[model samples]
Target: MADPTTPPEPNESVSETEIEAPRSRRRGILVAAVVAVVLIGLGVWWHSTYSEDTDDAQVNGHLIQVSSRIAGHVAKVYVDENQLVKAGDPIVDLDPSDYQVAVENAEAALASAKANAAAARVNVPIITINTGSNLRSADADVTGARATVAQAEEQLDAAKARVEQAEANNVKAQSDLERYKPLVEKDVISKQQFDAAVAAAASSKAALADSRASEQAAEDAIRVARERETQAQAMQKYAQTAPQQIAAQDAKAKQAEAQVEQAQAQLDQAKLNLGYTKIVAPADGIVTRKSVEIDQNVSSGQNLMTLVSLQDLWITANFKETQLRRMQAGQAVVVHIDSTGKDYSGRITQIGGATGSVLSLFPPENATGNYVKVVQRVPVRVDFTNLAKEDPNHQLRPGLSVEPKVRVK
Candidate 1:
């Protein structure tokens, strides 16, 4: 509630003095401006003399997708996300029970096939022996039958001679009986003598009958011998088919061998499948995006993680198409990493066939209305040489922002 305006004293005027304050502040600001100008000028001169022409780029490498080759529950995961690994390192282990069972089954099948083959081989000799024995028996029977036929033929010849002799005796006996009867009627001889002659004649006639019966028996024996010989010949014919039997056995053996080979192939396939249970790193790299965990079930070819190979790294620079006029493969380049403030030496490796926008998921339709011309960007790949000598530990990685400069000359 004091008076709004009042006259100031000499002391108050002394406190409010602003004589050279604005001048001092202006001079300080001017000096700062001059120093900034000098630093900028020095920087421009240094860049023009030593710095290389650079374009915005990124570090790129092979992005390998790791997956399971067989279906099983993951028993163990040896690696974690973002972990570094070397080639042949085990990454995931699947339950090997199923594969082991398959291998065992295949092995059993192979053994069985081998046993069958061995058995078939043994049968070869057995069949040969049996066939040989049968043929020998048939041959012996044929020889015996031929001997019997010869013996029967000799007996028949003897019996025929005996029959002729008997017929002549019978003729003599009939003539003697007629003469004795006439003698008895004429009483020229005694009755006893005539009776004796008649008895002798009757006995001779009976002997003739017995000889005829012997000849008939000899003929029947010859027929029997011939029948026996025919039976032996038929048996010999059957025995002579040993070669055909051997051929059939050989075919069976061949079939068994083929089965063995087929089983062996299956065993090999099963072993290969078993090996798939242990998923290992394909190459030396850094692992990322590990999706598998212990006790997790995975199917064949399912994505498990990614491997970024650090052995080979390059830079992908999206340069304006106009800048490509002077760029070519094999040109030396300078790559500067913004993140680490490190410099790398490389060379141009490749150039894209089309612009970046043209390969985009949704490309710009220039035919549509409101088309605004834009400077197209072409991707250029710059590859590093002597990478192992530079960083053997693989410190450089993909997706790192870099500035790369190419020397046209």
Candidate 2:
């Protein structure tokens, strides 16, 4: 212990100490802590800002409805629920009885129509022949009528000549009778001669009457022949439409042919519908939602199930507005699925025009009293690059949560 008033002797190391030393040491430590905190903050900020992360997204694809196009009973269902299928795979079958009967009926109708068409075609020739014969017969009748007219004219000429000769003879007989009677009256002629002259006059008068009757008969024959000619002319006029009759038969044949074509078309349609009874798949896809059962009476336009195309899968990412500022169409993106920790590459195909809420059925109305400012999300469509060929797991499904990232330059 040293005296209280004396200054203590100091060691060299201890003498070098000042009040500022501890402060300096503390300041250096504070500086070093500040530097370390700044570095840590920078590292955390870099991690938060630049580190790649997965975003919440969904895998989507076309959900094609498989329905019956024709009405029938369910015959068979080839696929079950969640059964993977390819394109053009059969899924269901309907009772083909009705369609089969319809096809048969249509076929029979087509046959009948074809038969009728054939018959009509045959009738064309028959009508042609009949019409031609009628026309020829009419021509022959006209020729015969002209001959009869010539014969009647000749007969009328002969009758007129005979009447003229009979008249001259009768006039001469009358003149002789008158002269002879006057002689007899004078008692210069014998009674027998007077009697003979009177008989001759009577004979001449009878001959003239017979000749007039013959002329009247000839005129009547001429009128009868003229009437026959008129009838023949009318018949000829009717026969002039023989060509028209043939044409009409031909037109009937054409109409029958058209009917045959229509019937054939109907038969083809029926056969096609009958084939449709076997519900063959239109393309390669997976079977889903199989609601049809055996012996079920299904009708047309009924929903049987759905088919999801695995090959045509795409990812729909609902990114925030801030995240989408760098995203653009045709940009390459990586998809990380939550179900399977696998990465898939795709390209941005399209972007939704409106926010998800705006497209919702009951969208938020900004004019309402309970309106709140919320961050809107837009859908971005991403198409996988050959997922069906490369992905062995095929884990991507519709409505599955996934993470997507788009690279921007």
Candidate 3:
């Protein structure tokens, strides 16, 4: 040390090399800082050009509502909240006693209708045969009556001819008897001859009377045969309705068959109702918000619970409209879940047709003229490609916050 407080000479101690070394160090530091800034800008530009990222993303999945198809009292509950179930698994069961009884009643009704149809069908042919037989018998009776009338007319004609001959013979016998009487009075004829002549005339007169009676009987027979013919014709007309009777019977059979079909339909409906009493899961999902309980009376179409499908999950990333210029379907994506702190690989499937705000319950009215321009966010759907392998534990759920990056290059 030269002195406690000594001031150094202005240009005696400092070397030119030392001064240049410090200046060089400062220049090197400035150059390094400039290069670092340039590199940082280039990195940022490259990342932005290659990929699009958004923090406004969430896991989305299918939300299924479970309900009852028919009205019944709940008999049993098979699941609790947050229980995983497979498709067709039993979720709830209603009292099936009423449905079973209805099915039984429908079956009985169907059987009865079938029996009635069978009986009606049997009557069709029976009626047809009986009517045909009646018709044939009536036709025969009419023909026979016509033939009997013709025979009676012929007999009447013959009887008339015999009466005429008998009259002629009586006339001749009377003339002969008159002549004999005159001769006997003149004492030129015998009494025996006169008696014989009188006998012959009487017999001829009796024969004429018999012929007249036979003619009357023949006429009466003809009248009776005509009456019989008219009656037979009436019967034939009545029996000719065989087709109508058969058609009526067939119609009845068809009606019974229709009833049978109706009863069968009712039976099928009853069976379906009985099957509906057992409520099963429509898909594989996690049961949540279970609102049904045992012994609860529920009505048709009543909501029972909610089922969340975790296996088929996708990411709904809301990105700025400007970022969608290069974003499109079939692009690779990476999703980072906030809950699991893990990244999942996925692919872009679709983009929403409209902005989320536009699809809201109350859309913005731009026509008010006082509207303020806002950068809208469009929803992009990114479906996980290997969620089954990446999230086997099923930690990711719907509405979970996630960060997704989509590669547009």
Among all candidates shown, the one with the greatest TM-score: 2
- The clash numbers for all candidates, in the given order, read 0, 5, 0
- lDDT top scorer: 3
How far is 296's C-alpha from truth in model 1 (Å)? 2.6
How many pairs in model 1 have backbone atoms within 3 A of each other, for residues 3 or more apart or on separate chains, i.e. clashes? 0
RMSD each, Å? 11.9, 4.8, 5.8
Can you give the lDDT of residue 397 in candidate 1? 84
The C-alpha stretches of model 1 lying farther than 4 A from their native spots are 1-57, 119-260, 318-328, 352-379
lDDT, candidate 1, 7-117, per-residue tens: 558856775567567788899999999999999999887665442354567898999999988899999999988898999999999999999999999999999999998
lDDT of 3 by residue, 1-409 (tens): 5984665675435666678989999999999999999999999898789999999999999999999999999999999999999999999999999999999999999999999999999999999999999999999999999999999999999999998998999899989988888899988888888889899989998998999999999999999999999999999998998999899999999999999999999999999999999999998889998999999999999999999987689999999999999999999999999999999999999999999999999998877678677999999999999998998888888999999999999
- Per-model C-alpha lDDT, please? 0.88, 0.85, 0.94
For model 1 the local lDDT of residue 321 reads: 80
Clashing residue pairs for model 2: 86-284, 86-285, 87-283, 87-284, 88-283
For residue 235, model 3's alpha carbon misses the true position, in angstroms, by: 6.8
